[model samples]
Target chain A: MSMGSEKKAKRVRIAPFITILFFLIMGIVGIMTGEVRRVLEQAVQVCLSCIGIG
Target chain B: MEIVRKWIQTIMALLVNGSWSFPFTRTIYQGPLKVVCSPGLNCYSCPASTTYCPIGSLQQLMAGIRIAIENGQNFFGLYVVGTMGVLGGVFGRLICGWACPFGLIQELLHKIPSRKFSIPQKLNYIKYGFLLFFVFLLPLTVVDKFGYGELWFCKYVCPAGTLEAGLPMLMLQPALGQTIGLVFFNKLAILVGFILWSILASRPFCRTTCPLGAFYALFKKLKLVKLRHIEENCTRCEACHSVCPMGVKFNESPENAECISCLKCMDKACKFDAITLEIAGLPMGSRAGARIHRPKQGEVSM
Candidate 1:
């Protein structure tokens, strides 16, 4: 297999895991502290703003 | 679909303005337990907010003159900014795009029938200058010996304050009207001007004024959500740029800091299905190259 193919396959799997892991970590922290929860929410808002959803 | 999306955006803003509570809400909702972020950047001290605004909260964080919370140990002014930064850094600019109730008001104003005026290219840079000169430098450097933090925008201007804070407070507590100073009237005039301008333009605030938008724009390259360009299929027509209000050259960099990701231009202009949102479908993945732009050097020094 070529190096490019190996990298693509690895990235595809890792990307989804990374995305999910981020939300999971945020959720756990959000539940623990009011500040963390608010920060996570603000993060979501910032994401939408960059995209013009806010 | 564009109209539909805009309407959906409108409703969401109303809900946030009315219900979503954040730190700023904590300032006004002292009577009963409530949390609500305003639809716009209104001052928490204005006495009219049904909800607290994030920027308003930053100002409120410094409401009293006693800066040393633990007897000169903790710096609240810096902390106020930290609150916004942590929020801005994590979510990027999504708050401005969808959740901000004031943004909703701007969107609705855009629907009003009027001749739209495009801002001159030269004046477009004003937001950045305002960011550096007014927002950070002046506020940080010029301090009142009494220790009350100076909020230039909130105190003398900011229409969001009038609509969300000023008007509401005055109406709710008519007694305040008797003691109103010239500052209230001056700020009201600026707010009214912004309102009138909003009717003729599409989110005048977002386009050239919002400091928060400026911050999130700095993070567009590495934001969690991505707007990808399928280069192989792109016709180089540059339709995206022509339609984009921000004048973003989407073909060169779809995720340019200026890009609000409204996706309207993409939805309307992309006849070739060249721009899309997804995670690793072969056609989409093959287009934008493998390298995601790493977060640049001090792109956001804030």
Candidate 2:
């Protein structure tokens, strides 16, 4: 591969780290804002729609 | 490697749906683990499930976003989005190939001795529509008198929900049969259709319908772990195409959005070192180094 292509490949490889870091920050904010608890409340109940009963 | 992948998939399916007590109790698991989201498309309503389905949880959040905003509650669903994002970034559609219970079921169903068919490539784009409409747009836009939206995907489309939760729940508690209506029958029809299609085609739902798989496909080009196609080493032999469950032609586009990273191309089909498993652009191992012995013809490599 050419040097330019190699550089592009490096950038592509780095993209996942950046994406993961951004989402991880958002996840921490969600947890701090009590999103986990909300999700838990929703999940604990048998979702009627999920069981095709709604 | 195929055997190893199958074992991992089976173990993952069992581990996520680990509430074995459901058979005797006839009730869904409400353990603390339900708070965690499984990476695959297993249903939270499944009696034996220990974790939530991200797509279902996402729909729940989307459907209630209006009410949440009016009530001054957080409605971003950042945690679920982040969870999905992190998993997708790390593995991409490898979860579909190796972890998803529904994907495993489809693969096993396809294994039943029968004539197989290929899905139209254009249909692959339909999943993005399902992700946009059923998972997000419909739920967020359409609301009831109370300003609460419905779980559109789970209620109308998800065969996983029907197979894992609906059928079992109805069988376990026959009293719930009174509640069955057109919607239940509709979902059952979709489930039956997909089951039959799975036998006829490989992973038809994952290829054409799954919103979660669509979400993961967004990260295919940038996922940390990926199959790197070595163009110079390739001989234009279309062996990889024949073995791909997701129908990815690796040489033409190494980063095809449809690829599930199942490693069938790398581990089973490639005679040349055209494909290599990579982590962050670094080649972890070659295909030859990974396989001890190759399966013979008609031996069920998948």
Candidate 3:
């Protein structure tokens, strides 16, 4: 393969791995920070009530 | 297959927002299922919604973190973000094409007999701006009198919220009429505009301004299930491009972020079996009698 094409292939291969890794790190941080529980607390309620309609 | 997918989307829509009496009760579903994240742009405020809206949860996370920072506390929400990332990595925008109730509504609207118009391809980038500004920046930065940041996208721009949650709330509880203000009317106007626009164009919201759709688009290249182009068999047929609702030139960029994995470009459009759905690198279905080979010039003459 040409150098340019090989470089493109390498980038494509590496992108997903990097993204997955970043997500894994963030997920761990979120759990450690108690963010997951916070989200759960917020999720377990119903407040919109057509008040803001948002 | 498309029909089957449509049915699944409809079923999911019904299943996720299945609380019928919540409208009269004026209470959102507080079931255990609420802890889960909806894979699409569903409004958590909707009485029937069984799960949290990922975009709304993300904005809440940012707002909470900002509040926490102000209070000298370290706080962040991982569940919503993690769920979104995992879902995006696995399915990409397949939710937009196949599972989103709002996307389904737009598709139905586009089917109305009207003079359809194609948007400029460049407009697709606008969703990224919406994602950066409305979903992230504004929600995290803009503060209320109590130093609380509002969910700007949900409060100001989300037509899905207005349609699913707002309308139903008002209809179910006439008492909310007294509290209806200018902001509600403005949102109503926006919803009407989207409804009208959806009729004239295909998936206009998904193409131009859905922050959640934009988020999923980022993971398009990384998703496990994807459309693969069989370059060897391709006859340069532009059928895939023509059928693509998102106007993706699948022949050139099969993994285009705009692609929703609707598979319309597969069985029907690509006559030479050029495009097929694959998990990892392996094709996922029967190949027998599926291909439509276009005859060569010599064969056509003969």
**Window of ten residues with lowest summed lDDT in model 3 chain B:** B293-302
- TM-score, per-candidate, Cα-based: 0.68, 0.93, 0.88
Model 1 chain B is weakest, by summed lDDT over 10 consecutive residues, at: B26-35
Q: Calculate candidate 1's fnat.
A: 0.01
> How many Å off is the CA of B41 in candidate 1?
4.0
Ten-residue region with minimum lDDT total, candidate 2 chain B: B293-302
User: How well does each candidate reproduce the native contacts, as fnat?
Assistant: 0.01, 0.70, 0.36
lDDT of candidate 1 over A1-54, digit per residue (tens)? 267754553453244344435545554443344433232232222111111111
Q: What is candidate 1's lDDT per residue for B139-229, written digit by digit as tens?
A: 5556677664555556655666666656665555456577677777777777778888888876777767766566556655444444567
Off by over 4 Å in 1: A1-54, B1-4, B19-28, B31-51, B60-66, B69-91, B278-302
- The CAPRI classification for model 3 reads as acceptable
lDDT of 2 at A53: 94
Each candidate's B-chain TM-score, in sequence, is 0.75, 0.95, 0.92
lDDT per residue (tens digit) for residues B77-188 in model 2: 8999989999998999999999999999999999999999999999999999999999999999999999988899999999999999998898888899998999999998
Docking class of 1: incorrect
TM-score-based ranking: 2, 3, 1
Q: Let me know the DockQ for model 2.
A: 0.61
Off by over 4 Å in 2: A1-12, B289-302
lDDT for model 3 comes to: 0.78
Better of 1 and 3 by DockQ: 3
